[model samples]
Target: MMNIVQMGLGPIGQQLTRYLAEREGISIVGGIDPDPNKIGNDLGEHAGLQKIGVEIAPDLDSVALLDKADVAVITTLSSLKKVSPQIIEAAGHGLDIVSTCEELSHPWQTQPEVAKRIDEHCRKQAVSCLGTGVNPGFLMDYLPSVLTSVCQKIDKVKVERIQDAEPRRKPFRDKIGIGLTEAEFKAKRDSIRHVGVEESVRMIADAMNWQLSDVEETLELVKADRDLKNDRIDVDKGQVSGVKQVGRGYRDGKEVITLVFKAAAGVTHSHDTINISGTPTFTSTIDGGINGDIATSAITVNAICSVREAGAGLKTMLDIQVPAYFDEASP
Candidate 1:
């Protein structure tokens, strides 16, 4: 059995711990969180699991106490600046790593220097590193690769990830600018405000060796005649409506695909799908909000599983199997 250390104890980290704790051949040796309140807390309690004898610590300085696990799953998201410390720490401890940091997903693209440093650190410690998550790692990149199996000549490829925002976490809800007016959304569209998913599209294009094209983005807000939030919350008309935002990926100056990501306090329907064209057009869709937190957790755990099975270097979701859910007590 391989012992593991997972960094970050936030929402995604908590879910990842639950999933990691379930593997028959994997043992969660320890966890790290920057939150002082969470430090020294029982891991099971943090995840609302019955006490299982593991506690969350403030840092991995206690690696010796934890027996120095064979691998580390890093999910902290404060900033790329803050996350670099965690990666350095894990590498210094001689533990292989799988991280959920955004820039790290396609490190070779957006942050080559950071990526190189991570690789150097891992190599110096004689360990490996992998960065992955939903958009940058799987849905956009690997999923597109899977579609190629049936196609002969690929003309265009598009991947769409649509989510209902009302149910998303508060931080993400605000980041998505859910209830804002269309103008308000556009006002913030300058360089400082744009999210990095475009990099994911670029990464996909690079991976597929697709020729250069243009990338365009559009954000839309749909106001409900009545105020609506989640499945539970409801309010009167015009208080604050829903929103629909689209992030598109294009090739050769033509709109090949678009990702419609939506969020609202209340909404009815939501789904995510990917469309590809070649000899035979192929499309695959997944249900629900993509649940960034849950998806990140599952993706991290799946990366860990892959690390054990596949000898590592820099890796992606295409380098491993899609995650599967399992109960900790199943055995």
Candidate 2:
């Protein structure tokens, strides 16, 4: 079995622990989270499973026998600044890594220096590190890249991921600016908007040899037509219900890739769509969109083996075997 350690205990992290526990090929050896509420708690308790022997530690320095673990599954902050230290520490222990940090999906295009540092460490230690999640890692970026393989001549690629925010966790809902005043939403636009739009656009373009001059992104709050509330938060009528964020990537000043992410409460339709403009143009859609939380956890767990076998450096979905659920205890 692959020994794994969990590196966060937030909403996504807890779900990841649950998924990891369910996978037969993996063993949870430890967990780390700085949250005072989580430290000392049973790992299984946090995951809503029966008690497992592992208890949450406060940091990587505290995870006993951390060097013996095969992988560190990080479901943590989106910012590379905050997550970089964890990456470095894990690499020092010679552990492969799989994470849900949005920026990590394809940081070569955005934060090359930080990416280089992490890459260098993983390479020196002979391990691998990857950042992945539903939107950036797959639907908007990797999936479209795969679709283009069937086209002879490529022109443009567009993807739409429209989601209903009501079903999402409170953390996700807050990340999209739900339950805020118009001013509050706009103020946190740059900070709270989905973290990986530009990265997603650039990953596809770079893979296709479509050099981009620049990438542009815009964010606007979706107003709640009616009152919307879940167990975690509330949104009043005419207040901010969600966020509408769009990202455009241009090559030679021409828009070659466009990604539209619309997530709001009371959304009439929820779907993931990809349209490729080429000689053999095609459109693909998934009704009722992929649930982000569950998919992120599943992909991270499934990708563990892929990361361990990948080149000793930073990787994206483009660089590794396609990650999917597997029942075998060994690969």
RMSD, one per candidate, in order: 3.7, 1.3
Worst 10 residues of 2 by lDDT: 322-331
Q: Which lDDT value does model 1 have at 113?
A: 78
Number of the top TM-score candidate: 2
Residue 323 in model 1: lDDT: 50
Clashing residue pairs in candidate 2, if any?
A: none
- List candidate 1 segments past 4 Å from native: 178-196, 213-222, 229-245, 248-252, 255-257, 287-292, 309-312, 320-331
Candidate 2 local lDDT, 121-227, one digit each (tens): 88999989999988789889999999999999999999999998788888888888888898887687676687899999988987798889989999888899888
Clashing pairs in 1: 165-263, 166-264, 226-237, 228-266, 229-265, 229-266
